[model samples]
Target: MRKAIIITLVVLISSFVMAQKPLFKVDTLSIELSDLSLHAVLTKPSNIDNPPVALIIAGSGPTDLNGNQPMMQNNSLKYLSDALVENQIATLRFDKRGIGKSVYPAFSEADLTIDRYAKDVRSIIEYLKEKQFANIYVIGHSEGSLIGLIALQDISVEGFVSVAGAGNSADVILKKQLKPKLSAEYFESVEIILDSLKNGHVVKNVPPQLNALFRASVQPYLISWFKYNPAELIKKINAPVLVVQGTKDIQVDDEEAQLLAGACNNCSLAEIENMNHILKTIEGGMQENIQSYSKPSLEINKVLVDTITAFIKNYSK
Candidate 1:
């Protein structure tokens, strides 16, 4: 009985150790901009050599590499990376300048422009190329979609995926979101400010209610963003494009994906049912969709994973 118990304990310990081992090799690397050193994680399948690599850019705000901000907590991007690894695809996710461990103290929001973000992505692409990653792709979510679209433009990439990206320019989307909430006077003020910014000018007389969104500190960055029209940019992409949108997304709708598909010569659109802005399957109403943003345990809608992986594999083959 004692010998049998010892053998069972040994077997269980061995199994635990094996299970503790990571399924893929992860490297926490840094990419240096002029003054900022951006932090990133590269996850690759342990068994595959020269596997397809994706540059996963997070959405708007201070969303980190794992798709979470300081007050927000979610494992959407991390789970997506795991899903990709299972499908034999590798991913490199990073914290953009002035976010997470890559924070730049000297840089203000004005320093954060669309061009700066694109250049950072370009640097990462160069790094991946140096490592000899043959199949390289860009996967941008929400605002990252615009960033990815601009970055991929002048760079050599296998394909591009826009996840929950906006179809219209920043001004148009802002008008849509604020129309129902703001008074006519306030809405007109916003329109005027947006138009001025779009036309290479900034408005100093900003409404107090709109200060948070159009703060002076972020106006320059907003101006830079306002210059790119998602639909127009999609038309310019030479590489294959995959636009994914969730039907239940409160922030962005399926029409955005459709616009992208219509504009791109080589584009595939996937409208995932019941998925929200954060890419989790909907369970209830708006509250449930918001709750999913904090639920780190919830897996991203499997259809998203399957759709993306299949797209990558199709081209790879």
Candidate 2:
């Protein structure tokens, strides 16, 4: 089944690879917000000074700096950072304000919104700016792609890359992913709640069974999220855009990438064959595909790394 559209309730288990005299130097960096700080892991080629850097925004959920969610320790983002650094570029992966090591004494999920997430990205960008990187790019995976689009509106970057990101708004995508499994009545409720959220309203009459997906506490976040449409937002970006999709991805389809590419100016579309949502290569049924999500030892698709490396290096300063 396709994944549902909801805040990911993730576990935090991180995995790391050890290498002596590693070509890259990894550091824990952070940026301060009003009452909290956001943390990130920066991996840069040790031999290069102020190399071009990519702010790698992870997908939704409790995903940490290593792209891991509790039981699933695939380290998807970590591998991406490793690959880029191996090719002489730097990458930074951050944990959201309340996730991973970004803890606030008064952290509240009720206070979270898509705009808030974008602001976090902006904060990280400002921090990166002071570091004197030669150039910078923003890469967002899954939900992070939309967050990147919203954040890029206020900041200028060398380029942007969207991986496994949805092309439509949260409301539209959610309705589609859920309609197949829900009963007729449940599906109707889904539509009603989504429509109300899209209109910037809170839904209080959520069915008891559907409360988990539309609980009162998360409605504000949903209200802010439903307002964004990726296709519409992509049109406003001034930087070069790369829309990446994978053939084996069960979460997002290829048409979504095409929707983004079609709307973006100075955009390039890369449809990677046999690549899954987590950016790993897969060649099997649903069971085999899902198993790959937990395999931290498995490397991500090489073409994905090469494609991004070439794209970022093309505009290297």
Candidate 3:
């Protein structure tokens, strides 16, 4: 009866999967800010009413609401959203102005600034407050962490979560990220451009090889971003803070998370080992860790979901 036993086992597995089916619904929403519209997706558990919502903010670059770029399809934020919703928490993730479906003709790259993104975050919070949710939480990844902190200054949120956020200022992180990738001559020249930008002056002539980075058009935004330090800003937040850092995160060191945790008395640091910048666990070497960026099929680390869910649930009213 070996064949009969195999069929019974398959039937049992299918039944178990059906029992754990998803119970969530997703809908598109948008908010208007200064004549520009930012689009977002709200994923709410079908079984929970007026559930506490989490605002998921993406990291740097043209990262879409799903935590993805034009070429990279890894659904880091999307999967995070699904996991949170499964735990009965609603999630709201949006596209910044001029990115993805949030693109606007009036939005110009030259007009962009870090404050612009922070303003969007504030506007979204107001929108959510009007919706009368049970409570609201802010979860920012990478640069979004600083933007969220900036937004939280004037508004009251349930709590805030920092995932792979930089502890130092923008200029400091830029220099560290670029030192290994640039030649000595170019590296020193890059520092000169950064110094000028830090002083609020635009460098007219950036090295041709580094034009993509130090271009004149992008300098204003850099100047605005480099002004705030995450460690300094986190001190001003009145709400509870949770800093999540991965040991394998090449972009941001685990030590950075400690700085953030150390700055805020109420902040708690969650140090996860073998987890990378994209929130995936490392099973092999550098190639596998880097490859996780493009692998959408691979699931995110389970420990991350548990940590976030427990934190939010503990604070939910």
RMSD to the true structure for each prediction, in A, is 2.5, 12.1, 4.5
Q: State the lDDT of candidate 2 residue by residue for 1-317, as single tens digits.
A: 12332223221111122334468798987677877878888888998787899999989878887889987899999999999999999999999878889978898888889899999899888888978775999999999999999999989999999999998898888888899989998798789889998999888788898888899988999999989999999998988999999999998888889998999778999999999999999988798789999999999999999999999999877
Among these predicted structures, which one has the highest lDDT?
3
User: Which regions of candidate 2 are displaced past 4 Å?
Assistant: 1-20
The ten-residue window of minimal lDDT in model 3 covers: 29-38
Better of 1 and 3 by lDDT: 3
**Candidates' C-alpha lDDT:** 0.89, 0.89, 0.91
Candidate 3 runs further than 4 Å off: 1-22
lDDT of 3 at 123: 94
Better of 2 and 3 by lDDT: 3
Across 35-109, the per-residue lDDT of candidate 1 in tens digits comes to: 878999999998778899989999999999999988889888999999999899999999999889898779788
Q: Model 1, which residues run further than 4 Å from truth? A: 1-21
The superposed Cα distance between candidate 2 and the true structure at residue 158, in angstroms, equals 0.2
TM-score for each candidate, following the candidate numbering: 0.93, 0.92, 0.93
